[model samples]
Target: MTTSTYHGIYAVVSRIPRGKVATYGQVALLANLPGRARLVGYALSALTDPSVPCHRVINAKGEISRRNGGSEADEVQRHRLEVEGVFFDSHGRIPLELFRWRLYADE
Candidate 1:
């Protein structure tokens, strides 16, 4: 992806408030890059900024997308979310309706 594209994704990710999460597709849509959810993931994977809060981005299923057997990173993401007061159900899935950040047209 172009640097501008990744920057757009980063901007959207940065807007995700603490204690809430957004799906990759949601980030793509908000970045005006609809239908490029996977691109959001790719951009996040390449993120080097510690302030971006990439952990707030998850899959559509409200679960962390596996990263080439990187279970440790998965744990870290979960831990961060929990610290922010996001919870996972017994199935290890977040209830998106409750924790997903919503951006209304006015906002």
Candidate 2:
């Protein structure tokens, strides 16, 4: 993806409020790049900005996705969410109905 695409993704991601989460597909669509959910994940993985809050973007299943199947980053993301007053259920997934950041009116 171009740097501009990543910038657009970053812009949308930066808007996700504390204690709320958006799915990768949601971020991709909000950034005007439809059907580029994995691209959103890639851009976020590449981002180094502390203000972006990439950890706030979870999977569509409301589960924290692991990088390279590693739990270290997943743990950090979960901890950050917890610190922001977002709770995880016994299944270790965020309840999307409660914590999803829906930008659309009809969603």
Best by TM-score: 1
TM-score of each: 0.94, 0.92
In candidate 1, the residue pairs with backbone N, CA or C atoms under 3 Å apart (3 or more residues apart, or in different chains) clash, namely none
- The total of clashing pairs for model 2 equals 0
- Candidate 2 TM-score over all chains jointly: 0.92
- In model 2, pairs of residues that clash are none
Q: What does candidate 2's lDDT look like per residue over 1-107, in tens digits?
A: 46998999999988888888999999999999899899998898888989888989999999998888555988988999999999899999999999999776323
Clashes of each: 0, 0
- What would you estimate as the lDDT of candidate 1? 0.91
Candidate 1 lDDT for residue 89? 99
